[model samples]
Target: MSPNNDKETPILPWDHFSNWVHAICVVTFDLELGQAMEMIYPADRELTERERTNICYLAFPDSNSGLMGNVQFHFRIRQCPQSMNAHTRPAIHTYNSNCPTSIQIEDGYLYGYVYFRQVKDRTLRRGYFQKSVVLLSQLPLVSLFTAVLELVAPEYFETGEASLEAACHHLDQWPPPTPATTLNLPLLGTLIQVRIPSRQDKPGASSLTPPSPTHTMSGPPSVLIPTPHETEAFRVLAPVLPHLNLLWELVITAEPLVVMALSPTTAANTVQTLVSLIAPLRFSGDYRPFFTIHDSEFREYTTRTSAPPNVILGVTNPFFAKTLQHWPHIIRIGDNNTGSPSTQKHKLKKASALKTVEQKPGVYTKYRPHLQADKGLVKRLLKGVQTGRPVEVQSALLRRHLLELTQSFMIPLERYVASLMPLQKNISPYKAIPSLRPFNPDEFLGTLEQHGPHLTSGIRGDWEGLYRRFFRSINFSAWFNARYQEVSDKLAELHLQAVCDADLGGWVCSRSEVEVVDMVLRLRSKLPRAASLPPSHPARDKLTQHLHTLFMALPEDLRAVLHAS
Candidate 1:
């Protein structure tokens, strides 16, 4: 079916017209100023006159009937005087008669207005005025017309250069407006509106006024825009410099000269390869290489031995080698022996077995010192081997083994000491000496009896001798005197009630003169004397005995006051 041929072209909706304007503005701004559409519009709102003018100028800087012409036309339309008889009915004029429709004079000038009469209806029409009136009635078309005028004569709006190329070149210098920059344009709009002159005067005076070219919109306060130099600086410094310094440090430092392997097969092959490479350099004594099959033995060796300040090589199971890598001095040999799946499984089982053996409580106890002594000898041997002088590495190894065998005859005292350390705190001076009572020998004996099974015969005998010496060396008299003096000072500072509350089990006795004197005073102060009872009564004697103990702890000089009471 054919479409309706008689229908007029549908007028574009207002929203659609606004959208088209916005899209054009976006492309124009992006090309000229390197900014996106959102950076300018940000939200759906009416564009301010200045914003519209700027957009127009940016879009069609060279057009003659662009933004400036539209603005001028609108200004002229608004400034035109109101017609005197505009509210009255239209006057009819016949074509046969030659007559003027209206006449007026202004500013000493006379003017006549004529209307063309249509013969069919004898209706009069002012063609130019009516056309303008019709144009004004269609608001959407008016907006479009202004937009077209803005494109056609943009130079008429712009105050500066008419050359589009020059304007484009100047726009190229501006950075793309970020979201932060767009947010502040409203404030700039408000300031520009305030500065604009009123509409009553000639529009040309304001038309020539241009916005400041160098004025910059301060971006949103919270938004930070990094400069190109800062961005480049972070890029160069963030990832690259630390790695460069690390590489430099590694290259400059001397380490990992000697390699030790734990597996016999791997160690022998590694050492042989190293010897083949190092023996040809005729600079050193025989390099005493160290290797061990046991992981526990290797750990013990490393723990007791300190290597010289030179690079060293170490080879071990994959897991142990990972730990050695953390040490800056050791250079590890990688395992290159490829085996079948079954063989690899066997290797894993063997490594697990070695780890289990190393973790066993008895293994550490039995082998720790032997490993310690061996490691010390190996260190000395390695130091000597580093010199140019010839030395027997095998002989030193033999001596280390022989020394270990000899030392086995003597029992290890370290286990005995470790067992005794916890017990030592219980019997320490601060804990044992603070009591007012005399020291008990039973506690020490009980501790010895409990820990004696863990010690060797030699250590047990030595411990017994030390225990006896500790007891004999303690001066009980001095301890008692010190306690007595401390109590006396405390009593001298305290009141009679405090003295009555004190514990005086060890130092207090009825026969002591100081005790009797101090107690009598305190008892007399706290308890009133009965009129009928003598001081020697049973009740008085009991109170006097208690007071004596309290009084004995007072200072000797202060005891004189009790004696007087």
Candidate 2:
């Protein structure tokens, strides 16, 4: 037979074909005379062997070929037992037959007789095609095989139905094959060779002639049977085949967008949810929903260091957000520090302070000028009351004037009082204190006389402490000045950095444009209003000009956004 015999033969309909295009079988062999012998010959074995033995059958319908009949095939392998010695391994052998089997549909079932001629010296070898055959057992196409079997031999079905509807119902329960299985097929056309007789042979030479039962051909040997391990694996994965197929479809078509959950468990649950949700849609066409929580597995699918992510869900770790930012397509959810309580508190405090600054304009200017004036008045009033006999004037007038002054500058005086107050045990500094009521001159003098010098000393000490605390607490000017200075310094630093970046070729140089723009925007936000700054302030003018220049120098698209804002 010619080596190209299989390729040269015209493809034939299933019923007309002498041999199968694809086939698989389960065979048992034992070692004899340093060779493996076929314990179960193809046709010599009873038909019951088809059911009792572990076998998988697959047949593809060629819609274009107009062949209603299915092509029946079998898998065969032969191997010698290995030697006990660690270094010594036995050689494997495959036997091919020259006499092709003729399969016929009888009683809605296919029956075939195959004869084999054992190739003694030919070593068993595997190529891409042979390996693919073994892999087919694990694929969704295995369902197709079972479906075809049920169609051909419905009586053989465990369900005891011999109708096409019954066969299709059985197929519905079978798991769909994995994408991998459907995708990989060996050079199937080359699996079997057909011989065509020349014109000199006979008048009907064009017709294929069945091989004599006695004749056996020698050809390449291969192991077609799946191992026990492979059978178990397929069985284990069969239930999930439908889900795998759904996910595969989603991935291939880029539907619903790829959402990578940071956790493996999350990913698994997400996949399950997505499969169920999209199952009803039943969108046609091939799609692969590929997802992996393992970083290594993700890397296997991506060619770049930064992969575009459609959506990033449940990324609680700020570190993950930082890493994911490198991906150009990542949809930013929010601040990375959003989950941090301390960060939130800091932002809240900053926001409150900013709001206060905006609402209470010139807070420092309003309070600073009166500090010295208020201090002098408080000292004079206290000194005058303590030293004067004050027999004619009532204490009520002095008390009312003191109350008015304290209330007039309540905020500043409160700050002063808080600063001077000693840290008292079991007392919170933030606690509120009640205001003192007015007292008449007679009432005050009578209490003073009754308590004598000790009362006088105590009252003087209390008054001094109150005065000190009130004075210290009224320094809002200093606080406001410090806050403004800090903000100013930060703005200056940002402006300097922006200038340095621009000098070094702007965003094109080391720094990312996005990061640079973020910095610029932050600095711009911190910039005080031109009206707030003194007319001739050099810093204000410099900042304004610097910001305008930076904004103008930005890319047209970014500049447009900024200008629009």
Candidate 3:
């Protein structure tokens, strides 16, 4: 037989025409018509009867797609069994402004379900068409991988005996189209032209073949950083950022319709999956990264001579406030504080000049304002009798650092007080005793016990001596003002003013202070039991346990109280 032809025939694109289309089948369960309406047509404001009835399906389109290709697969709306109203036949109706869109039944869980279908048809004019489920694991990756899959792989998902397992069986046998081929004419030509020296050649020639591509990792090597930005996946996901709210809307609408008990964990997991899908797209490190934003304008400020005078940029963003609330994480001056005479104040005045002012990429300022808040709280309560305003207190990690700074401050104050005590001991009383009005420690004690839970609780056991020394040595007002400076100045001032008023026997205390004191006292009483109680407590062992639970239960507005004091 003649030598078999080794040359391969090049594949023509026209010979193999393949079209892929995705179809979505939405299966809503236990959802009534009214419940579905609310889910599909949620609005910031309540809609009237006519408006509610005419509710439109507001769906967002896929952001990343080829110009000519179909991006979003399909949209479907359908009804399913109502677990809540299985006994009673239900009627869906539009409710009045006060009433929300809901199922007519007494109880149930509603599901706004979605089914995905990806269809691939090859143009095989002569052959019979065949379809079969194909195992995804068996297929070589044709599309980019997702982090979500890495986090919770298909194997980890518990597709049960009848549900997801059966659905997955269908996924495993999908008849896969042949792999598309790509050619590089230039590369082929280069390969052919490359001459190899034979082993028979004299001198240093050796017989060696180039390494095959199969031996090495196929893609170009890259350094993978944990930074969410700078990834190709992030770029693809970014466009869907605005539509992130859609998931939340879907849940809220489905909530009233379904009577089944959807565990909070289940709901939260679903929401998180949705968040993971959307967050990757909006992973812009330069701007807002989370739901809340830090908003503050940076102004140029004077600096020390050792350090070049710098433009002070004041940040008023709530995020910064939250960061400061963290205890020991002192914000410090950026190391890149070099300022040239050419790039000075007048340059900042110019439009172009503003861009030239350099900021140290990672430097931060010290905790000036934060320190003041800690010292001032006591003084303010004592003097002004003014309550602390609504403030977010950083706890756990934040508390750890803050407690450190407070302890450091108390040490110096205590030393000074000790020195003063020795001086008093040295000085003898005069033979003729000067009549003086008696001072009552009770007045101070009552104020502290009632208003300052941090002081009271922290003073328990041996810590009282440490606390007393600091109080004895310093002018609490001056210390408060100095530590906080302009940073935590407002809170410090409030606390100091309160203290001054209380000391002078003035009726300056406000109802707000009384309320704050009551809150602290109650919280203190509850804290120990919550900490000590076993997980199996029949009734919650402490009120503090309810704080987080209550927070999760309330509307977002009321939930804000957790962050605010």
Top model by TM-score, which number? 2
**Candidates by TM-score, descending order:** 2, 3, 1
For 1-565, candidate 1 gives per-residue lDDT tens digits of 1122333556333332221122122212233343222222223334444333333322221212112111112110111223121221111111101111011001111111111111121232321111010011111112222322333234312432233223223222322221112111121112211121122323112222333445435422121111100111111111112121121122122222334333322333333233222111111112212222232234533442464333223233344433343343332222333210111212111222333443211101111111112244334434443552232332323323332332221122222323323232233211112223333455544555545423422211234443343234222232334345555433332333333344444535434665455445445654553212465545445555665655656677766765675
Candidate 1: segments with Cα more than 4 A from true spot: 1-415, 418-503, 510-552, 555-565
lDDT of each: 0.28, 0.28, 0.23
TM-score, every prediction: 0.14, 0.16, 0.16
Candidate 3, number of clashes: 58
Per-residue lDDT of model 2, residues 1-565, tens digit only? 1122132455323211112211222222223322122232122323333222222111111112222222222121111123111221111000011111111011112211111112222344321111001111211122233223423332322232233233233332332221111111112111111222221222112232333434324433211211100111211112222222223223222232222323222222233233222211122221112122222233433434544433222222223333333332221112221111121222111212332332221101111111222334334434544576242132223223323433332333233334333333323211222222222333433333343333312112233323233223212233333334544444444444343333323433454667557656754664654334567755565556656656665688998887678
- Position 269, candidate 1: lDDT: 33
lDDT of 1 at 216: 32
lDDT digits (tens) for residues 1-565 of candidate 3: 1111232545322211111111111211112331123121111223334222211221111112111211111111111233122222111111111111110111221111111112333554322221111111111111211221221123222331233233333322322221111111111012111112221233122233343566335633222212111122212212222222222222211211010001211221222222222221111111111111111111111112232111111221223333222222111112122211111221112112212332212112221121112333233222321243211121111223323433433444333333222222222211111121222333433444334334423322223333343244223433433333423333333332232222211221332444443443444444443444466653233344433433444457544654585
